[model samples]
Target: MQAKHQLATPAKVLESYRSPLNGARLQQEKVENLALSEQIDQFIYAYLQFNSKYQNATADGKIPHPTKAKLLSQQRNKLDTELETLCSRSSSIFDQKERGKTLVMAVDEYLLTFLQLSFVGQRSPNTLEKMIGRKKRLLEFLTYKFNIIDLSLDKLQYQFIDQYYTFLLVQKNVMENTARNRCNV
Candidate 1:
């Protein structure tokens, strides 16, 4: 039937579907995808320019020898193949969430989520303030040690704890008990 065919169309199916996740997360994902797409476009433009120049040079006999020109052509072909493969694979990158692989949350984002949940659970304001203060100190240490404010959880190691403890004791010159509490936080 005409109505059945309309319902089966890709655009209609997408329009009728609703996602359970929050809008902010979806927006963030779209932003990341756009950035990646922009990067790919830039690479493709650069490749086209390079290919044009290579073709012009080959036609004008600017390349010194036939053997060298052949080598250069082979390398160019290999690069073109790589670009095509990348373009083909890029579509699946956004589908990683459906493939059961969890995306890594940055340290700051993880902390913010934790704080938000704690607040929603009616945690004491004093406790929340202490957590915020500790987070600030931890961020400071992270920046000092790695030159980064936010890091992926997978990048952390057991040594990070020891290093952080030492930083609190030595850099902040806090009491041992205070340093321990901060580390616990």
Candidate 2:
């Protein structure tokens, strides 16, 4: 009765049904079939294959010791989590493209699109220059915060806005009003 109850628990039941591959086979197949243009996607596919082979080797007692196997498994799990994060970020970008949405991959691209669509001839040259200056400040902040000029819009969150505002005020030594203006842009 106790064994039945233990097996019936949600966690145990879920674990029992989960594939040992943890859907890596399906993800690998998808990666193989998709004509991935990004170099990152290709790297991810290679990593997936390497990870699968590593797991198989470990299971075949290549590691030989229980402790070392456990340690390697822990490290592998951490890498797997990071890989999943990368996959989700890249997949979301691809999905956005497939949906026929205007894909703005970087801050500068988004700024250009916004200006072209909304204020090309309507705004004065001075006003456009000021807008561009604001965008430069934003790009500076993004570079300081993320180390990358090209960031996916999908990865941005409310906390990013808050952090950028703080970065402008503290790191750039800008006034609160100026920080607010930069953030609003």
Candidate 3:
């Protein structure tokens, strides 16, 4: 993990983004910032444990047990998916409007497209409004957790489902029952 340039920054993220930096009144902002820091910590810890397990399995130049090898493969795939989900979220935000990148639809943009197809005409005005509000919050959480500001579903991973669940509980400070209701949306 330390050998990779990308992985090197994981530790710094937690420090830089931690809440209560100056002990000031922006307490809400600081609390909200916890999501990204926790994401980095979780990613690095998971990667290191996975790496160590893989290394120990083959340390003696012996073939891993079939079950161990299969488990390692599954872990490797999960880590790859997590890394891709994190890295792909980082794009040159500045180059887009200048380079005609705005013309290309992102996952967020597709939200409206799907809404039209699924709910716009079929649902009542109040129902459509609630649906849009839920989706907006979901997209906002995606941006917070993954640094994925655009509507890009390709950057999403199964891991994010759990991350978003935690984000609601932690950063959003939703009540247990309220979180269940919000998450179900």
lDDT of every predicted structure (CA atoms): 0.58, 0.55, 0.54
Highest lDDT: give the candidate number: 1
Q: How good is model 2 by TM-score?
A: 0.40
Q: How far off is residue 98 in model 1, in Å? A: 8.4
lDDT of 3 by residue, 18-59 (tens): 754554634432332344334433554565566567768999
Clashing pairs in 3: 107-151, 108-151
Measured with C-alpha atoms, the lDDT of residue 133 in candidate 3 is 55
lDDT per residue for candidate 2 within 1-185, as digits (tens), equals 24544547767667757865446754553453233324333443444454455567677567637776676567656655654665565566545543322212343334333333332245343444465566566667777988864445567789988998999899889999988987886
Expressed as tens digits, the lDDT of each residue in 41-158 for candidate 1 is: 4554454455455666677656647876776677667766765565455545534754222212232333334433442454543454455567668768988988874554456788
Top-down lDDT ranking: 1, 2, 3
Model 1 misplaced regions, further than 4 Å:
1-121
In candidate 2, where is summed lDDT lowest over 10 consecutive residues?
A: 99-108
Separately for all candidates shown, the number of backbone clashes (residues 3 or more apart, or on different chains) is 0, 0, 2
Better of 2 and 3 by lDDT: 2
Off by over 4 Å in 3: 1-121
lDDT-best of 1 and 2: 1
